[model samples]
Structure formats: C-alpha cells, structure tokens
Target: MIFSAGDGKESEPSTPLPPPYSGHNHVGDIEFHEILAGTDNFDESLVIGRGGFGKVYKGCINHGENLVVSAIKRLDPESSQGASEFWSEVQMLSRLRHCNIVSLIGYCTHEQEKILVYEYMPNGTLSDHLHKQGTPLSWFRRLNICIGAGLGLRYLHNDVGIDSGVIHRDFKSSNILLNESWESKISDFGLSKTCPTNQLSTHVNTLVKGTFGYLDPNYFRTGKLTRKSDVYAFGVVLLEVLCGKPALEELVDGEWRNLATWAQDSIKEGNLKNIIDSDIMGEISPKCLRKFVKMTERCLHDNTEQRPTMDAVVVTLKSVLALQEKLSMQAAGSRTIFGRMVDLLPFPTNGENSGRVEHNTLAPSKHGDGIVVAVKMLTSKTRQAYDKRQTKHIAELAHPNINIGGIFECRDSKHKYFNQLLFPNRGNFAEPLSWGTRLMIMIGVARGLTYLHLNKVHCDIRPSNILLDEEFNAKLEGITKTVTKETHISTWVRETMYYMAPEYFWNGDLSMKSDIYSFGVVLLESMTGRKAWVYGHIEKASLVDWASTVKSRIIYLKEIMDPRLNHNYPLQGAFECFDLVLRCIANESKDRPSSKEVLQTLERIYALNK
Candidate 1:
C-alpha cells in the first residue's frame, strides 16, 4: 500500500501531468477537479503539519470585507496515495455533522488536485502539549482533552442527527486538535465506516482498511473493526496522558511497544515510581494515580467486550475528575503528605443508594413514533438479572434510531438485588403484529443493527430476540442479562453458526465478519418472513436455503417480503433493499462490505429517491 518516488518505488500515473510538476509527487491513479477556480489564497506560512497523506495548511476564506480562517488540507499531488486520501476524506466527512467533530467547510477538486478546508484550531493538537515543544499543559487541561474527545466520539456513535454512525479509525493524540481555550475536536474521518441502513444489499463484503500504530490489534489480525477497537486506541491515548509518553515508543531495549503494557508490567513488579512522568510526580496523589491507572487498564484489556464503551469512559473520567477536585480542595489546608493521604479517601455520594432505573414512554402515535422505554425497575427480577453488565453500555446508547431507551442502577433494598433493568418489556413478544406494522419493524431492525454493525458492536442477532415496539422499531433484545459461564462460549458459537460464513462455521472462529454473515441471514428473514432456525421442523431447514429457493420466486420484491406487511411495501426502496440482501448473503464473507461502506451505499440510494 506504500508508494514512494524517492525510493524508486513509484508507478506511472494514468494521465499526463500539467506543467510545473517538477519535484511534485504524482498520485498513481487519483484525480481531482478544483471547486475554487482561479483562486490563489493558499498561504505557505500557515502550513501546520505533514504526514504520508499530505500537508495541512492554515488558510482564510474571504467574503467581501469579512474573513474566516480555516485549515486547508491539500494533497501533495506527489504523495502517490494523496488522491485516495482526498476522496476518502470527502466521501466520509461530507455525511457527518457533530459538535465534537471538526467541520469540513468546503473542498476544492480541480486539475487533478484535491484540497479540503476545515475550521482552524488556534491552540493546535494534543500532540503539541504532550510531545511537541510548548507550554506544558496542566493535568486538569489534559483531563479536559480526554473528555472532549470522548464526547465527540460519543456523538459520532450515537447522535442520529446525521445519516449514520461514524467510527474514526485513526484515533490518537495527533488526530485530536485543540482550538482557542483548548477545546478538542476530532479532525479526520477518511478511514471511517457507516453501516448500511437497508439490509437488502451487497455492500457487506468490503475489506478492512486502517492505520498502523493506532489500529486495533484484534481488527488488524481479524479484519473486524468494532467499537471496542476504537476503545482500545482511546485506551492507548489515555495511557499516554497518564504516563506522559506515546503509546508506542522506543525503550531502553531499543524495541517499540505500547506504554499500556509497559506501565502495567511496571505496576505488577512494584515499580510504579519509575513509570509516572517526573514533572507531575509529587503533585499527583496515589489515590488519583490508582483510579487513573485502573480506568486505563480497563480500556486496554485484551477482550473487546471487557473494554468500557466511550460513554462509560467519559463517565469514569468525570468521576475521576470529581474525586481529584475533592482531593485538591481538601489538600489546600494539609500540612503533610500523610495528612493528604488520610483525607484522600473516595467521598461517597450524599444519596442513601445510587440512582435506580426508571422507565418513560412516548404516547402511542404515528409510524415510528411510539417507543416503550426500558426502565431498569429495581423490584423486577428481570431488571436485577440485566444489571450484571455495566451501566455505561446502556445510558450512552441513545439515537433517534437506536432502541436502548435508558439504563440506570440503584442500591435500594428492592432494587439492590438486581444488577440492571431494561425498558418496556424484557424478551417477551407474543403480541401479534399487524401487517402494516411489520414493514416499520423491518426498517427499525435495519436501523438498530446498522448502528451496532457500523459502531462495531455486534449484538447476538436472532429472530426470537428481535423485539418490536408500538411503532415497530425493532429492538435487539436479550442483551440486558448476564451470560452464565458454561453457556457463554457455546452460545456465541451457535449464534455464529446460525448465520456464520461457511469457512468460519467450519473452522469455529468468531469475528466481525461473522456479524456480516449474521446480518445477511437476518436480511433474508426480514424479506421472506421466516425464522433463521426452527425448533421442531422435520426438514431442519436453514433460513439461507429457504431464501435461495425463493430467490427466483421473488418476481417483485414485495412478493417475497414479510407477509406481516401484507405485501404493501414501498416498491423501489424495498426492491433495492432486497438486492442488498442478496449481496449480503453471498457465500463469501470477503464479498461483504463493511457496515460503513454499506451505510454510504444506502445513503446514496436514499438520496437518489428522496
């Protein structure tokens, strides 16, 4: 994937270059059309940074007497990979909008050159304070940076104000820039992916793509990028903030490794005194250091499921900040280090018990309107069973399209026995759904699953598990409870087998690609109105086989559509969805596109029609 002219490793371009191309690197197969024609506004002094992609320059956009400064990201034209990077950024950023994310103001594509314009950050990136020479950032300032970055990421993952979920594949200190007053903004999205909203398509076969140092190790090995992977990268950044060192750096042994493992090893060997940055050595108390280390360790854990979600991380960091503030306030009058330590114990909240789960509902209304919120009821055994997992996963998972209402924890005698409580009904769906409602059910199912897939959180997708609300927003049920040890591994295996790719089922490995396989089977069920696996069928038929048999019988997409709708689905959109389903079910997992890519395809189709 690396192409360089200096090393004599470059390939010839497809088209002839314009004059004055000397010393400029040529992109092998990429081209651009300049949107800002006859403009000479780029400033050389504003050049901020450089990378394999290209240089980032500060620029100004003029309108009459008013001026607006912005960051102009231009392709080096000679980077060889610059063209791909340019288009990739445009393709991803154009569809995203969030408070924490930097805005792509505009772009210029002309004469085979690509340039992206963004709002400028006067304070520069976190890399400046942490690594590059600058006025040293205070510990509180660093904590704020982590909080802002987490909020931006959370917005990308859950804020449905945009078209789909966004996963910033390259998340790191360098990618996080600070503006005036040090507010952090996530700056890049070229390698991001959005899951397809419509399940009936072929976009799930695309191959995995991302950066090296920040890349999720599991994803790098398995080609399955999940939200946990992003958590892993964020964990590395958190460790950097704590240890005051890069995630991967050269050590005394002359080898490169992540600081998380190195710091953990130090802590294990009783050498914590050696790892902390000397600048903040005496200033930071053991209580603060312990909580910070514990939080970072949870993030760096090997199991993706074990890593806290961005929401949870944000909450944990805030709690840490609160504890830090309390200690700082108490330390103002302390005479000795031991006295400070005695007063540094974690102060319990004033409440008799932590907050309990509560439920709310939007009165039943039109299609997609009425939603029954799952409140974690303290008195309910079902809610107690659901509390085994952390609350961070549930509270942070809200979107106009995502179905998790609200999840809370309480310590009351009635509620203390339960671990977690879910909204509305917990895994019960005997109520008969109307034909008209089923179509909405299909769409809701697509939206929620698409969110999970794109965000890299794969729910155990199944028919009996898919719940429907009054508005028929398909909710992925059965996750509120804790899994027993004996059934855990086998359940995951069986779930994988139900919709697993042939190669994976034969070999018995769980992967993100396996989710794509499951999605394809789920799409088949949505289209044909059949379960993936039947309990008592004499033939022991699989959903995939039934879908193939009826593929030819599908004269019109509605003909094979879920009868719950009575075949009154939207004609073209439904058909297009069916086509996507066909592609998703393509025998090879390699043929499936990543959820982000699929989401883009669906957006294109939705745009064309809407």
Candidate 2:
C-alpha cells in the first residue's frame, strides 16, 4: 500500500467506482489523436504548467464549431505513477461536481500515452497569484479563496463521502486553480485515495504523498493517510495565503525546512508583524488577524488527533471571514479620518463615543444633539465623480429605518473640499438578536427599501449596507450613491453579486424587484443565521439556491432555520417568513414580489406576532 516517490511502482485507482458511475467511467475518454491535434502536437509553447505527472497544455476539447478550451495534463511515459494517478483523477473528478471542485472534461488513453482534460482555468493556480507577485490579492479576496477551498474539502470529507470519501493527498496552492471569475477550484486528484464509509476507522495505511512543504508531518512519519492529512496540508496553504509567501521547501543552516514549520515558529515567538505580509499588515483588523492566526495554529498542530475535521475548519474560516468583513466596514476608534473632516461648529467633535453608540459607530443627528456623528471622508477621486443632484436628494431624505443623515461640502481657505458624509450609529446584523427582533429588523429594512423605491432611489443592498441601532432597528445605507462606477470597476459589483436578482446579475437590467430580491437574501440571512453566499461546497453555493430546494418541505425548512433560535420561535411565523423569502428570490423578476409587497408581507408577519 506504500506508494513512495520514485519507487518504480505504478499508481492506480484506490477504489473501483460502483453502480451509476460504473457505466459513465468511460464517458470522458477521448481519442489520443484529438488531444495532440488540439494541443498542436503537445506543443511546448502551449504548456501552461508542469508537474510530477507531466506537462499541462492549454488545448481545445473539440474541433470546429464544437470546440472548447481545456487544460490537458499528459502523463509522461517515464512517470512511475502515471497510470495509477491518471485513473484516480479521471474517476474522482468525473463524478464529483461541486463549486469548489474542478471539473474533469475528458481523458485519452492511447498506447504508451495518458492525458486528462480539465475545464480551463483562465486565472491559473492560487500559488501564481499569492506568491508569484503576479497580482496582489486584497485581504477580502484572500479570505474568499480560502473559504472556497475549505468548502470543497468539506464536501469531500463530509457530504460526498456517504459511501466513500476522498483524501486529496496533494491539496496544495498550485493544485488549486482559479477560473475566469477568480473562483477557486481544487484540482489534481492524482494522489487522491478513496476510503470506505462503513469502516470503523477512516485511515488508510499507505505511503505518504503530497507536496514537500505541504506534506502532513504525522502522515509522513507514520504513513497513516486520513482526511486529517489533507487538513494539515491545507493549514500550510492558509499560512501561505496569510503571510503571502510560498510554502516551498527552504534550506536554512544546512537543514531543509518546511514553510509551515518556519512560519509556525515565528508565530509561536509572538512575531506576528514579522510574519505578516507587509502589503496586507495594515489591512487586516486586529480581531481578524488574531482569529486567523489561532485557526492556522490549530491546523498545524502536530498531534493528528488534535487536528480539526474539514467541516469544523470550514465553519471556523467562515466566521473569520465574517469578522474581517464586519470590522473593515465598521472600523472605529480611528482619529485620522476625523482630522481630515470639516465638522460644523454646532455638532462639535467629542473625541469619544457617547457610550450609547453601539458597535462604536455614531449617526447623524440635529445640529447640536451631542451624538458624535459617524463621518466618512470622501476621497478627491470619488468626490470628483459624485452625481450632485443625487447627492442632494439622498441628503434631504429622513426616515427612521434609513441611516443616511447628510453630506456636508465645506471647503478650507485653500478651496480644497472637506466633504463629510454623516450616518447614524453603524453596526452589522447583531448575533444576539432574537428571532422576533430579526424579523422586526427585516420589516424595518423592507420599509426603508419601499420608501427608497417609491422615491426612485437606486442602490446596492447587502448585509454590510444595512445598519442596526441599539434596539436592533434596521436602516438601509448605500442610498446616496452606487459607486459601481468609482470602485475597481468589478470589485463592488462582484461583492454585491450574492444578493443580486438573476435578471440584474446576468443582464444590465435593474428594477424595483432587484432591491426586493436583495431584501429577500438579507431576510434569508436573518432567518437561517447563514451568510448570503457560501462558496466552499458546490451544492450550497448560494443560500438562496440551497434554501429554495427545501422551501416546499416543512421538515427541511426547520433544519435550515437559525440554530441559535433553538427551535424556540413560533413555527407558523418562521414558515411564513421562509415562504416570503422564496417569493422574493423568484428567478424571474416578474415572479418576484415588489418592494411594497415585501414590506406588506413583513408587516403581516409582525402583525401576526402581536
């Protein structure tokens, strides 16, 4: 069972696929001539990557009108593991279909030739982006990629493993490919092993396999391959992403060292700043950084028993992502921004929060109400692009559920614009909110959106754009502008894709129902305590898609409801809210309820509560 490197032993599929997949195993087999022709005779110039398996060429799947691009990984004839690894990848990837798992297009098994085709990944490997200095990934982007990869592993270890689970012995950054949309998909199942679910234990007594730096220490020492082995390797990947360093083997003091060991040593010494990538050190919030380090540390724990399961890892990473996002949007206790703002005389600077400001944020008030107003300073570039008429209109509006207060444009003596945009106390969806409170907040948000819809206001709505008060009252922000034009072009648009209606998401169409669709997603979040978008596993890509599948089944509906509710809330009320969410997120805009209707349904829910 030991499949050691350079052992001159051929690798093969660990487990034979059973019924359903047995017939389809050869579905992706392509003729050898077509692979060579598509790849221009395996042209050197067409090579996108090289590995132990052999060269991966950027090739076409079909010729003429049916042509499609693909990454054709051709196993070298000299490769000891060629036949074994080739069959494993073809078997596993052919049947697996998850958002985070890469798709296997087809394969060729000609005389003395082995080639496997995969869906072409335009953005290349995660390693290329993280360590090659190709493009610096923002903290948000890094968090997303990690979550996606983690979710993919979770599926392999948890859901997909009902009969037999997979252990990706080579789950390194280079093996993780990014599609055209920058979605991370785990690839290269050459070293994968399938274990039986009916077995009393989930370990395979086999030779250790994985990238040098990412290889699990416990597995390497004892040759006990389990799902935890993949967890250990992924910990190294997380460390690499966090530190923005490649987990390549390094030689120090005449002893070759692993990146995980080196980085973990630095972290143990409390040299966080020393290990953090200088480019993103200032970007990561203190709470987020601390939590990330803690999770990474647990993953690298030497005791195989202490290593968390992929399911736990996924959940922990999700919370970490939410923390980073919340802190970034609701940063407080910073005086540098206040120094740049031109505060009016009546609403003076208090130099401190008024204790009543929940989440350390302040809102707009009457000229001298003594509430330290939450002010955001607009950059010169953004200030230049402001739609003046829209700005004026947003500033003039007043509603209890709307957080926007006013925009002040007072210039210094030198004619420089010191623009101060004031919003009331800003906080995110509070975790402590009761089921009833969450429903009330959703109603308030619906009311706010309805008002904006009636007023012809257009804006993006998401969890971050919605603010809460001390009493859990909701207010909609992002009303004054749609900075889709000012942001990195696609960054803002990409972030809001989670809540966008299908019509607006696909085409350029935006309507009143679009806002309602977004409200539905937020309502979904409130009800289920789940994020609007989930990327780790393919089956649960978006909460809307996952929830809609079970909307008709009351038993399944109860399962998706927020666990924090303890099943203590009124079932009738929860069911009604769930139904409303389904209606709001209807695929077709015409099928979706209007903003006014959303508000009315929420009001009905609230009235029934009384």
Candidate 3:
C-alpha cells in the first residue's frame, strides 16, 4: 500500500555545521537544532519517509569528532497516539542491543520535537525490494534474511537479558530494514510489549493494535496479546517474501484478500506452486520446497498452540538451506558422488560380494562395533537398522578376504539392505599403510577384481571404493550390480570420467577390459599415494598418456613411490607394481592386461616383498 513515505538516500555532505548543540550522540538526546541543521531545517527534498506520526528524514549530523549519516524520525506533537508511541519507542530502543535489531544512535526532545536517530539503512526496507520491484533476491538470499530475522524475533521472545519477554506488536515486511549487505534488521517497536517470564500466564490483556492484514484474529477477538501473535504476523511476512505479493491485495471485485488466507488455503489442498514467486519457481528443489511450505503453513495456524516455536522455525529454515546448497553442488547426471550414495544399494547375499557398501545409511551409528550382517525384513520394505549382535551371518559362501552377509525379503517388492560398518577403515590414505599391510590389501584387491571380471564390469573404481578391515583385508566397494548385460542397462549409471578407459570414454562400452583399466588407476593411486589424473578441457591428456609421456622424467625409483612409506617397501616389488600400473592404464583396452594376469603379477610382487 506504500503506507510509509520513507525513501532514504545518500551520504553526509562535507559541509560546516552550525553547532549541533554540544549534545552527545550516544543513546541520549540529539539536540533539536543539530537535527534541524543536519536535515537542512526539514527540507522537503531531504524527507525520506512518513508515518502516521510524522516524516522521516536522512540527516548528516556531527556527533563528537565524527560526522554520522542517520535516519531522523520526527514525531508529530499534536497526535496524542503518536505522543505515547514516541515515548514507548524511545524507552524500548535505549537499552536494547542486538545486531538484527536496528541501532538507535540517539533521540531528541526539545519543547515537543520527538525525533529518533538511527543508523542509516542504505538498501531501505524488505518490502520495497519484494513488492516494489527493485533488486531481485535469490531464494538463497531470502532464506538467509528470513533466518536472521527469525533469530532476532527468538531473542526478543526469550533470550533477551531481561525479566520479561518481548512481543513485537507490529511485525511486518516494512519494519524489516535491509542494510547494504541485505541483512534484515527488525525496526519499529513502538507497540512492543514485555510479557513476564515468571508468570504462569504470559498473555497481556492489552488493546488490540497492529497493522490490519497482519493483526492476529485471536488477539483482536479477546484482547489477549502473546508471543504467538507476533508469530502470526511474521508468518504473513514469510508469505509475502515467498510469493512476492503484499500482505493484503485488492481483487478485481474490490474486495481485500489476506495473503496468509490465500496461501494457507492453497497449501491445505497440497498446492503452493501456483502462488510461489515465479522468479524463484525452479530454484527451490522438491524436497526443500515441501519442507519450507509446510513450515510456513504451521506458522500461520489459527490455534496459537499449533504454531512452532521460533527456535524450531530457525532450525528448519537452516536445514532447508543446507539441502538446497547440497543439491546445487551435486554433479550432473549422477544420483550420488563419492561415498554419498554408498549405503543405499542392495546387500550381497553371498560372502564374496560383501566387501563394499554402495549407499549412505539414513543414520550411521557412531559407536564402533565390528560385524558384517545383511538386512532381514520381518515386515515389507522396512528401513530398519539392526547392528552388531542382533544380526547374524546366514551366507553359505566363504572367503577370508570377502565380507559375508545374507539378504532376505519379507513380502515387499523392494528389498532392504544392511551390512557391518567396517571400523578403522584404511582406504584413501586415511592413514599411511605399512609395507606388509599394503601387500595384503593389493593381493585382496587383485583377487576380488579377478572374481568380478569373471562375470560383470565395475563401472566406477577409485581408492575410496576399496575398503580395508582392521587386519588389512581389502574389499571392493561402489558396485551397483552383481551382473548386467555386457553392453548397457535400462538406467544410465554415471561413472567417474577421470578413471574411465579411452574405449569406455569414446564407445560407451563397459567391457571387462574397462575394469582392468580402472583397476590400473586404483593401483597407480595406491603406489604413489596420489590420485590418477582426470582429463580437463585445458589439459586433454588421459592418465595413460601422462604415465607413458612422463615415465622418463620420473626416473628415480624412490621419486615414484609414496614418501610416507619411508623407503621401507621392497625396491623390486615397488618397481614391479609401478610398471604394472602403467600397463593397466594403457590407452587401448586391448593393450591392458586381463584381471587374472594383473592378479597373478600382484601376487608375484607380494611374494618378492616377503
């Protein structure tokens, strides 16, 4: 409605001032003459805003040694309501100190001129940005601002260092001032009331007095003001921020509709898409959108008891922001990256396939208990986590190197997978592995790869995909399927392009030889304790080319091995392993040795170290 005429602007002009009345500028009286001189005797051009009380002006006043640019609010003496509000504002602001709440530099009371001086807000109010079409705020920025304001409101309701809690009688967008950085500062507090903390009943039986559209209906009906009334008003502001509409809008029929009523009505029918700000329609993910909309709806709930505490609201908003950021960082065409999706895939039915987990669990238990067990569902498709002693081995397949677990389905279409959480994991250079431990891991990896290449291809292979138990028994992980068609599957699996063989890169082939190529990358990573090179647009060479091209430059034997090993590794075996890695990462799949051959070579190298 453009209710406030405040249009704040510009800097403190470098001009001589006419003795600003020798008044202190720190939370005391700013002399009336100083304000007049600072605002050029209330010039029409300097007027920034207006309220029912009076106009607000941008003033440049000399305070002590420094000149400060401030927003000067001059109250009307004739209006009896404004007179009381002026005193209320001065009382509330003098002692209160919070970052999100605006800072009051000083006030003026000279024979009737009631003026408030505040730190200059350069970006003006949140209302101006949302409804008036100035700068477009991204969903991320909006979320942060809302969180900041929520924290401020929470402090007022509980954390304030006082005997009573504060209830902001008028909590709306216009009262939210945005600084140069767009941080939200809750401004107006003339109607704020302090509810006692020690009392059994927190409500104050005060006259109902808040803005029309944002006024709590319950407060109006019974003249009972509580903290929840402020929550209801804040809910209206949340809706305004999300939908980019005014709290009250006039329809074509000339009837006014409250934003909260319309949005809550749409949300009741399980729909918020229609009213969401079109500018940020696609920016909010489905998961984040559902969470945010539901929270906003609860904030507007009619029964005060049903509404969430400001603390819960703050936490939920933060989580929503966190989820949004994670999605933004997720690599394209991949459901999971690194170990993010590790605990979601199926648990192996046999011991041979139980080495690595392929999905992250819903909640990973922090206690370190060592046992490998598969999920047994007494009910259908239940995601229940049973750890350690409660789960037992039911697998017939046996291998000392392979982790064994069983998988059973009750009556559900989708099977539940569970396995032992390996303790003291030693992959990805978690800590440097000793020479003897390295040999054990290499041998296990070779045997596992040889077994897998017998039937299917492991699309993604990296150092992180290799898991080692406390005894250094290595097991392969990140495998999605025990078997798939040799060429392609129904769903596209995104493999790490950096570890991919040239044949797989160009021809889209997941041949058994591709496993050999990826194994080569893993082996190289182990020997050097460094990652295999990924191709980039600037440097188009693959790992094979780099290895083949730079082999002569890396002539010294010690230069190639990981220095963390302290040259403790057997020279001959280390030399042989390095050569083997070069052969596996060959440019052509045909040139790469078979998994069986790689395993045999690794076993031979293992024997040399002994």
Candidate 4:
C-alpha cells in the first residue's frame, strides 16, 4: 500500500510500486503513521540530529516478532532536498549492502512527508567522537575506523557489480557513523554519483558540490570528478584523526588556515612532530608514524594519477596497525626504570649531537623527580676533557639556555655519562622553524653567548650545538675555550669550517667577534632553511654569498624565506630580522654588532611583532 504524494494525510493506493523502486519493500502508509505517532508531528525529545535535509528522530518499531530501533530522517517540505533527493537516498542505500556501509532498515513516503529509516547507531557520528571533546580515541582505534571507511569505499568503487561504479562525493568525518561496539560505517549518500563505466572516458564532467574544506581542489577547479576526488577528502579525514583538529581553523589574527595545506608543508619540511596531536605523543611508534603520514601525503597529491586506490590505502593501514601492535607488545615487555618503561626506538639521525646521543625514557617520580632523558655516551678520547669542562661549567654557570645534562655514575662500570631531558614532540633545528620560533631561538642563543663571552669564549657555535626544549627554547651545548692574553688560533680553525668567520678561515684569529660571525650564519640558515655551505649545486657556494647577491634587492626576500612558513609571518619583523642577520654576518670583524647588540635587536623585533 502507498500514500498519495499531495496531501498531508495517509491513504492506501490501488496501483503497483513504481518501476524505479519495484523490487524494494514499500512500508504500508498506516504502519508508518503508527510508528511516527501521527502525520508531521514529531516529538522534540526524540530529535537526535538536524541537517540541511531536515530533522532526524529516534523511534522504535516492531519488525516481525522483534522490536527494532531505527533513525528516521524526516525531510522538511521547504528544504532544498525535495522528491529527487528522497528517491536518490532510497535507491542508493537499498542497492548497496556491506558490513562497512550503513544498513537501510526501511523507508516511508506518506503523502507530502518523505522519510528514510536506518539501523540506529547508538554511538553517534565519527565527527562527534573526534572533535566534540569526548573521550579521546586511541591511535589503534582511530586507525581501525579509517580502515573500515576505506573498505566501504573499495566495495563501492571496485566490488559492486553495477556498470557505473559509485563515488562518494561527500566523504568526510561527519558522514562516518559509529556503532555501539565502535564499528564504523559510512553514511549519507545525498551527493554521491555513479562514475560512467565507458572504457574510453576516465572521468565524469559534472557540477561540483561538496563541503568546503574537504572538496578536491582539482574537481573544484575543473568541474571534473573522479574516484580520486573521494580520496582527497579522505586524506583530510586522516589528518583530522592524526592532529585532532578541524579541517580549517581561524587564527587569533582572523585568518582561516587550511589543515591540509599546513600539514603537507609541515611533513615536507620534516616537522610532522610539531603538528601531531599531543595526546598521541609517545604512543605512536616512529616507523608507524612515518608510514601513516606518507600514506596520507600520497592521498592528498594534486595529481589524480599519483593517488593510490582505496584498496592500496586499506592494505597500508592494516600494515601500520600491525606495526603499532608489535611495538605495543614490545613495550609491554621492555625494561622499566623507576616506574616507566623505556622505548627502545633510536633517535632520528638529523638531531644527533655527535654520534653518542640516544633516546631514552625515564619514569616520573615525586613532585621534583626527573623526566625522560636522552643519554649521551662520551668517547674515551674526549671523556676526560668533557668531564672536566662540564663539571666546572655545570657548577659555576646556570642559565635557561645552557645544556646541563645531569651526570649519571654507574657502579658496575668505570664510566660516568650525562643525560638530557628529551623533547619527544619536537625535532632538531635541521627541520624547519616557524618565524616566531626562529626569533625566540635566536634571542636565547644570543643570551647564552652573551653569558659565555663575559667570562669564557665559545669556540664552537652552530645549529647542531643548539638544542631546543619541548617548548622550543634554545639551549647552548658543546665546549667553550678560556680567553687569555695568548690567542689559540689553530684550535679554533679545526672546528666546523662553514660557520667560521672569514678572518679565522684566512688566518687564525680567535675573538668574540668570530663567535658573532657564526651566529650570523646560523641566523641566515634559520631564516632561509638552507645550510651554510651548499654542496653539489655549485662549488664553494656559501649561503652568505647567496644571500648577499640577493640582499641588495629587497624584492628577492620572498625567494629566500623559508617555504615551510607559507608566508604566514609578520612582514615588518622579517625585514628587521634580515637586516640584523646581515649586520652580524659582515666580512670585517669590526663591522659586525656585538652579541649584546644582537640580543637587544632581536628583543625589540619580537616586541614589535607581539
């Protein structure tokens, strides 16, 4: 029995079901009236969700001998979704059947009322669980959810028997629903379309309509949709899960930034640790993290052909989950010091200070107990000298920028070592630094140098000697030489050549101004994201020379600025900082500013920007 499409009341139809919905079960008009209590009168207490289509109500009904709960989506008569969308959803859900796809229990069309019923998902939408400040999901749970969504897409694109494969045009976190047991299922097919199966054509040219942040840039630009379009949206969801942030965020300065753009840049610049969610820190394995990020990067590639298929994505996720499981099991059996188990993962190669630094974990103890620290092993050749210098320096000097790794003495061995607290969520200066962070680091380094120059001189100054704490505060490390009436030129020239001043490189001239020259080189590297000496590109090509070539023309600053920043820095501060860097790197030792002057300039620039 069917109801007429005109009036708001229900009436039995004498005709057969239409050909478009021929084989599907059409609920009787009288049965729907009883389930909904009456015509167009829904209880506000039962309203579960509201969308562009209309309001969704939770209701229980009798299916055969069992009581079944269902989500009934009732479309408003004045909504943009009219008869076309109602019929489209009915056809789509009825035809597609998979474990990962939301199940369609039944539908109702009584007079002017259009409603669709789905199996009630007790846990609500994936968006609610992820961004609503609820209980945070574990890394493994989030990975499983993404795998389930990928499987659903694989079935729609490849497993379905229809000549035209299904493409979920609006695939975002909100469209993913979670069940009572936390199983994920894809829902909402209002904007989905079937790709033409013709052998000659590769895509379907159509009008583009989707959520703004998740829309594929290519599809939005060309109005040509492909299966990869859905892949692009799924990439955004992957980032959301990893970072626990929205697809777009408005900054305090009233700028709306895209998550995908920021994430891609961060990853490219080896700054993934900076953008990852803090909750998942130290929980994710390094190998798994790298693989997961690489997969998401591939999915977000601008070239459609470069993006991997949904089947490939599912396989990669399964592998990542397996690695995470193995690491968890290993951690369970790992050795614990104090009360925390130590992760056996080695430190990244780029952040090592000498060949001795290794990542180690230490458990928290009482209120003033120590935290996880990285152990640095000293070689026999340098052990005596390092011990003498560190013992004197650690006892005499105490500053926020100085690296004071506490000494650890082992009873069984004849060697004593130093351990520094580790920053698990930050990479070394080899990775890119935000403009603000660069300024803060430069100031900290200058202050540390100022303290050293007042008593002793720092013979070695480079990016590798500067360590950043978890808060991105710079700490100065390595050896310092005593300044006496007699200058030691040979010892200073033996250090890293790239950062040494020209006067020291030409002849052995060791002074405080020489340290200022090295600081200038580091400042330039921080700003341009380039090394002091660029090899292979040109013979004996120095970063100072490159900058000086373009320094005269201020318009060329755009080419030299760190690309990872994406031009999201303060322009006035950048120009001011560049001018300071130039003064510090001047050829003549007398031409450069003193360490104190450099510190004051950086402080002023930071203040003006703030």
* Per-model TM against the reference: 0.47, 0.54, 0.52, 0.55
Q: Would you list the C-alpha lDDT of every candidate in the order shown?
A: 0.56, 0.68, 0.67, 0.69
Model 1 per-residue lDDT tens digits across residues 1-610: 2211122223323353332212122212212322232124444566787787687877566423545676767777776555545556665666556667787666666665667777788888887778779667777788888999999887766563434566666788888989898889998776665543222121221234554456666666555556666777888888778667876776577988767677779666544544555445445544566677777888878877788878898998888777667666544422211111111112212212223321221111111122212232322323334343435445545544444522222112222100011111456453434333434554555566566654444435555455543334456543432222112221222233456555443333445566566666766665565656433232234566656666867565555666655655456766676677777767666787666555555554454445
Show the lowest summed lDDT stretch of 10 residues, model 3: 414-423
**Which residue runs does candidate 1 get wrong by more than 4 Å?**
1-43, 63-65, 80-84, 161-163, 196-208, 251-254, 333-610
Any idea what lDDT model 1 has?
0.56
Candidate with the greatest lDDT versus the true structure: 4
lDDT per residue (tens digit) for residues 1-610 in model 4: 0011223222323332442454234432225665576323588888888877788888876655666787888889877665755666667777787889998766777777778778899888878777785668888889999999999988877765557778888888888888888888999886677775443136766656678778888887777778899999899999999988778877777998788998899666534555666556546765577689889999999988899889899999999999788766644433223311111112122222223222233222221223334333233443445455555665565677765433221223222111122111345443445677778888999998888777766756887677665566777765433543243322211125667676664345678998999999888888887767554331235677778777776555688887877996788888888898889888888999999999999999888767
Clashing pairs in 4: none
Give Cα distance to truth, residue 69, candidate 2, Å: 0.8
Better of 1 and 4 by lDDT: 4
Which of the predicted structures, 2 or 4, would earn the higher lDDT when compared with the native? Answer: 4
Ordered from best to worst lDDT, the candidate numbers read: 4, 2, 3, 1
Worst 10 residues of 4 by lDDT: 415-424
Ranked by TM-score, the better of candidates 2 and 3 is 2
Q: Judged by TM-score, which candidate is best?
A: 4
Which model is ahead, 1 or 2, in terms of lDDT?
Answer: 2
